[model samples]
Target: MPHVTATKAMPVPASKAWEFVSNWGGTDKWIPGVGPVVVEGSGIGSLRSADLAPETGFPGRISERLETFDLHKMSFSYCVVGDNPIPITNYLARMSVKAISKDSCEVTWESTWDTELDEAELVVAFNGLYNLALDNVEQLMLSENQ
Candidate 1:
């Protein structure tokens, strides 16, 4: 199993950050070249499919299912379903936000997956993606708060 985690501090309230991150269907807004997310069902157990933009150089569609959701806890768990472009299987990920202060928050994204490929390589790749996404979120939240 390969596991990776990425955490970033955002200059925004936890509530504001959570509202952005918890939108299971709105990932395209902050995940860079990912967009056109289509979701089925709702809440926990809902399924979402996202298409990676062709220019991203890593184009493919990813499907995921919400395994758990807790608005009160500002956290959620999801599992990748069906075929994945990434060379991994049984992928499970969790995301959470914690308040560092009234004006700031910390967000963490972590995942574990089974992979036959190089674990270290995958860890770095996943970490990069998570961190980039978090960075995008932070920028958007700050702009909104201004």
Candidate 2:
């Protein structure tokens, strides 16, 4: 599993940041390549969906798909459903939040991707996506603060 983790100091309150990222569908707003995460059920076995990278113009988005969704846990673990757009064979994204202080919070986005891509190639791609999401969250929180 190719993995990447990113952390940023959000301007919004820890609870505020947790509310946004804890929702599965909200990922697209912060994570660059993420589409709207679709959820059907409620937990462990809940169904979810998204467009893979090929469906979009970006290469990384190809692995996006509806897998399992868990709202109560504030995290999502999914696999490639089928007919994804990218070269990824197996992929899983798990996002979590941790409070550091009254107004400070940390959101950790971790993903494992198995693709035809070489380790070096996937590393660069994963890093870019992770950083983009971190920057997006930072921007969103900052705007909310003001």
Candidate 3:
């Protein structure tokens, strides 16, 4: 299994961070590489399809299902289902926000997947993707507060 984890300090309350990240369907608004996302249903078991931006060099859409949603914990887990553009399978990703202060929180995103590529290669790719997404989240959240 190849895994990648990235974290960033978000200048927002944990609840606010959770409210945005946990909305599975709202990913396109913050994830820089994702195009419009279409989601079906709500809450646990909902499915989300994310289309990758052509500029990212990875074309195609990936569908994932919400596995666990814990608002009180400010965390969620989603597993990739089908139409994955990445060269990996059995992908399970988790995202969470932990409060650092009354109006500050740390967000962490991690994932584990089985890939045909070597572990090092897969890790490098996923790391870049996760870091970019986390940076986007931080920037988007901060700008919204200004």
Candidate 4:
């Protein structure tokens, strides 16, 4: 599967930002392929489960189990729950959030899936998601900041 990556900055404290993005269930609001999250345990090793929604090319649900995570490192990793497309399922996607200031943080999304998912197609989908998520977040931050 081809990797999809996008980065965005938010004017919020690192702790606050971490709390928002690190929550598995919280992803539905921003991520395109994710819905609600079910988490168990605690810390990075905590079990995170979520349903991947249908996108442009496909319309089905896929479950992912977050296998690794690190709050201090601002990174997390996950793998597909079931047998999926040979090329699309066998890979990992990681996301990291870094703080640039007390009120500014940047999130970097990266994945290394093994596939030939037309780079352009993946990019187009990701771009829409990234822009939508970022814009929504910025608005949220501004409203909260006020």
* TM-score versus the correct structure, for each prediction: 0.94, 0.74, 0.93, 0.75
User: Tens-digit lDDT track for model 3 on 7-88?
Assistant: 9897889888888788778898877678889999988999999888777767889899999988888899999997688888
Candidate 1 lDDT over 24-85, as tens digits, reads 99899988789789999998899999988777656899999999998899999999999887
Backbone clashes in each candidate structure, one number apiece?
Answer: 0, 8, 0, 3
What's the C-alpha lDDT at position 87 in model 1?
81
How much is 19 displaced in model 3, in angstroms? 1.3
What C-alpha lDDT, on a 0 to 100 scale, does residue 126 get in candidate 4? 59
User: What is the overall TM-score of model 3 with all chains considered together?
Assistant: 0.93
* Model 1 residue 66 distance off true place after TM-score fit, in angstroms: 0.3
Query: How does model 4 score by TM-score?
Result: 0.75
Best by lDDT: 1
Question: Which should have the higher TM-score, number 1 or number 2?
Answer: 1
* Candidate 2: residue 8 lDDT (0-100): 69
Task: List all candidate RMSDs to the true structure.
Answer: 1.2, 3.5, 1.2, 3.0
Please identify model 1 stretches exceeding 4 Å from their true place.
55-57
The lDDT per prediction is 0.91, 0.65, 0.87, 0.67
Query: What is the lDDT, from 0 to 100, of the residue 17 in candidate 1?
Result: 94
List residue ranges in candidate 2 displaced over 4 A: 33-38, 52-76
- lDDT for each residue of candidate 2 in 5-116, tens digit (9 for 90 to 100): 7666665566677678766556667766566666666545545565544433454323334354445454555565556665666677766666677777777777777877
